[model samples]
Target: MASNVNIEFRKLFINNEWVDSKSGKTFPVINPSTGESVADIQEADEADVNQAVQAAKKAFERKSTWTQMNASQRGELLIRLAHLIKDNVSIITELNTIDSGKPLTASIGEVLQGVSLLTYYAGLADKINGQTLLSDGPVFSYTRREPIGVCGLIVPWNFPISILCMKIGPALAAGCTLVIKPAEQTPLASLFIASLFKKAEFPAGVVNMVPGYGPTAGAAISNHMDIAKVSFTGSTEVGKLILKASADSNLKKVSLELGGKSPNIIFADADLDYAVEMAHQSIMYHSGQICCAGSRTYVHEDIYEEFVKRSVERAKKRVVGDGFDKKSESGPQVDEDSLKKILDLIESGKKEGAKLHCGGKRMDRSGYFVEPTVFSDVNENMRIGREEIFGPVQSIFKFKTIDEVIEKANNTHYGLAACVFTKDLETSLTVAHAIKAGTIWVNCVNYFSPQQPFGGYKQSGIGRELLVYNKILRLSLLYSLQIKTCKIILYCLTYSMKFCVYEMI
Candidate 1:
């Protein structure tokens, strides 16, 4: 929590200039703690989307200087941008805290991690390489790991800076131009980041942002034929829409990192105290805005009673208050809309017969505050247990068998992330392998690295992003058969072909 977080920030950023909404219509960015208008953001539409696309197209077309530059030189530019971020780290961190109305500690610390990711990707820029394969046919048996064209990145409101760094660092490192659409709720930090990129002189349209609603801006990015790749982070439902939209349109490469209703299973032998804390952190962090939030808690039948008791006590102890207030452990919800959804889900849980174990009421005051909530006697079939509540709410269940628990955990449309807490390495390995999520944790939750490839299974997403040298891997696999001779000698060895002189050299 940071009482120092302020919200009087910039409105919009497009093509290196700060501007207002196209129709002069501004949307209020509320401080969830105070229910006050902290800042106003530009409400972009199709016109703004077109502007961003055109700018990206122009920048990508001007491959003369940027495209011609050595990968090492491009890496230098990214390194310089990283240094710039470090120099002005405080301002950007504060911007994130204010705009998202999340805890200042999480905001500030995650922003620094974003800078680290940029630096890491910068260092990796020159290392991206395709391999010289032992080809079946003759010719240049090697591939060139190059970039795709102008890419469109649509980031979510939750974990904005960190997620933005994930896409931008890798996309730029791959030498792709971009058009960015930041979520409407937390667009200020993105606008400021655009300003930072401008200062870093990221070659005008190498990176451009248009902050707006998802329907207009987000849809536009996917449907646009000019975009060669689309990287999106949001809900599973919306990710499906983006996938359909891209398929209906250009069939361009679409990468989606979507939702999760993670399960944190605590066996009888696990430490009760540590289990309670991990359960809370799994769903309570960022007011439960995490996509991979461990909303489901499955405890062994032997310790189930004690687990719920301690978990409720822990939830009650949390100081629910404003995000800006440094002492506030649980901050307000992002806005009225998000709070309504959360409260509605809480009521749904009750109406559906799940017992409310702890805090479930909205705070009787200004701002979008909900008490640190938990549910007990929850069935796996309940909507609260099945759907992605995406709030500071937790539910507990009991199980006897590891296989049964694994089935309960994987019984969802989502496969984003999951957790297991036990000392038995054999059991840990077994349970981890059984879970269907993209990432699994033995005793950890919400842990991530830019180096680790992150995405989901089923309808959770398609393809992958935030990966290093992944482009090289794909290029090598896709184009390893680029060689072609007349007919009979088409399958000749690389060393035996006439073109072998240059290919082998």
Candidate 2:
């Protein structure tokens, strides 16, 4: 086994120990900005995944110390982890920046988000208690919330630590052990954090991270009967596979935060300046790699042309270069495949008769960089208009009325998130209520809070993450009956069962 200092040869972290894969397989993780290999990460196959799951299961059994620990103790550990992350924010940020090809500032912000989530869940751990029932019965009964055994957490590469905390914080707060499968594209920061878990004195097998591809490690986690639950954040197509795998194995609980082709509706009676600025940031942030990116822009016909012009100018001013560069606002795509996909989508938009406002090609460099592209006169049928480009590309559509825009915006199968830029109270409320999305932002874009429950309606996702409500979902309900004084046994047979249950809205 290699030492923890040598992160380049990063290995799987199972049972609080860094070990090589059973099959001795490893893959190269590339730096998208330079098209160079950042490190060769150890790959975990089904065998490795099973070993990790077994370890986690053992740690989660009824008699294990981890499961028996006090809820407040667990919260203290999470708080310690948060402080550790804050102390080492620079290293984590750099690792994430090079591994995922996102700007340094963005990576730093993501790490801070992770820390905040951890802290939030830490404070919420001891407070996760059931309520008293108001039933009129002589029998005393209450519900107990217990950890849902071992959990399988699968996180994506875009916002690595941010999404990981969304699951890890809550799972830990609920006293559930884990077997995490970090994305192959960006595994550096995850491995580093695994080491932090060790430093924090987290028990062996309580929180394990296995870096590998989705097919093997991810599939094993989803299909493992011992795994009580699986929380996945990735594409919609992959989310389907996970749902099937869970049902096929043990009918384990599944939570999915999947893809989105979200729409940003800009009404005429709104602040055009703020709308244009936010719209640009919505699509161009992280080079449009966000799952809930406002990719499809629906502008009111009254100011559609002007909005498009300003949006294009804003895109042109953004500096695209190395992620570590202080002056660079945007970076390259994750890899060659992502760059190719974005280019292909741009061509399809052009062929489909959408006017290319500017930047319809890749930058002339050795890296996997795509220009910040914009398209106008885009109809619903155009490929770029409906499909998620997942790159720095925007497709603007013109609408005349609120009803028409609402109908068009809600046309896609995805409903992860949507934004409305309007000052009119009636129009904003009506549009916000009418849009079938999990998160509806009025006069803002890409704003997230740990307290707000986020998930999707349709094919976008199945469950939520990063809140006290989500923490409750990671637990199982155990009801116990306490016989108090019974009046008439035969006459009291129709009495309501009084049991305390925690409910979320």
Candidate 3:
């Protein structure tokens, strides 16, 4: 994996060209698996953001090639981009693993998912259509959907490439250009994908990438007047800032996919073995760095003890090591800060009186590694059960009845996602409808697809992503028009103009 991986694209990508930051400043990209600096990436600042936004503005101009291209042609470009990504999956996977500390298999899966997403949007590009309304009078009225102009896409570190594609596919299919700000922790995969956009023959400035800290480049994107919309995926705190910035500036359309402390409910009648495994993966996969990870597990009191015992045993046996290793089930945290935060949260759980069943300390080995920790006998008030601990820490809480579990599940401000494990259909549907989350999974966890629309119901996020048709429609503007025939005009003038006025209204 090391031999195949290369950090070739590190500079800010503007107008289909690689260039140093205007500030000439650089930041080191650390390899979390080794706690070493892999490469120095050019840090994009406000000036670089302005340049990229200008490029996107130009590309989105009415007469520009990107705007003039037919919908089918845009779809072709996306298909080509998807192909290019599929062809270079290995290197991108390696880059993601090295940059974000995700296991190599998970990175590859995300890359493939990106391809599927692009392809889905590509198919929907030419199929977009507007509505024609029937008028009471001899007049024709219709609505046409047009591109919303240049968009600012802010990607998160947890799933950079996949989330970037989620924004890019629909924006391009809607004929909008983009200026992307990749997360500082993991910008390598995004910058590399920018090169693939060029290889796909996408017009210059159609896709631009600025790699820098959030306060600088990200703030510029949120506050930029030229950007028509801003789509962000990250923490809920940062999402609030972006919303405020948009309101303070041009009031651009903002869509956010934010943080979540999702609930995974296990009933007494559930297949205990399968439920345990799915619940474990829900919290443990990607070291619990996922935004919608099921960090809170609610178990029925009848099976609570057995579930806790099995979960602890599973955590004890789980592998936590370098991402490149095939046998490793989990990888290191993205950086030292994440590692420290997880450790601190684990300590808080202990202090708050949640029973730490197993694995509460950081690994003694190098790199930002932490043990797969499990805490049982957790309550709703406990920090471990309530907080969004974005780490390999699992918190299990005991519940009595269906109503009790449902109340416990909806206690958090977050309503991103939840899962219910049960063999009975009535119970599944009952819990699914009772839950306030945007997505409810029955007998499963962490299953995602391109066709599924994902977002949140409360403080978790603002808008939906994927579901190509709806997403692309949201990226467009609806323009309504009315036209009267000559016969109708003559009749109106000869008879009563009030009729025409009423019809128009």
Q: What TM-score do all the candidates reach, one by one? A: 0.91, 0.92, 0.93
lDDT of 2 by residue, 207-314 (tens): 999999888899999999898888999999999999999889899988888999999989998778778887888889889999989999999999998999999999
Steric collisions counted per model: 3, 0, 0
Q: Which of the numbered candidates is closest to the native, going by highest TM-score?
A: 3
Q: What is the Cα-based lDDT of residue 121 in candidate 3?
A: 90
lDDT of each: 0.77, 0.84, 0.85
Steric clash pairs (candidate 1): 1-326, 2-324, 3-324
Ranking by lDDT: 3, 2, 1
Error of 1 at 450 (Å): 2.2
The candidates, ranked best first by TM-score, are 3, 2, 1
Give a tens-digit lDDT track for model 3, residues 1-505. Answer: 3535778998999999999999999999888888999889999988999999999999888899998999999999999999999999988989999888877878888888889889989988898788777778887777677777788999998888889988999989888899999989898888899999899999999999999999999999999999888899999999999999999999898888898999999999988888888789889988999887889999999999999999999999999888899888889999999999899999999999999989999899889999999999898887888889999999999999999999999999998988888877788888888888888877767767676678886889887876443343442233533321110001111211111101221
List ranges where model 1 is wrong by over 4 Å: 1-12, 19-22, 136-138, 469-505
Model 3, runs deviating above 4 Å: 1-4, 467-505
CA displacement after TM-score superposition, residue 127 of candidate 2 (Å): 0.6
Candidate 1 steric clashes: 3
Best by lDDT: 3
Better of 1 and 2 by lDDT: 2
Model 1, range 345-389, lDDT digits (tens) per residue? 999999999989988888898888888998988887888989888
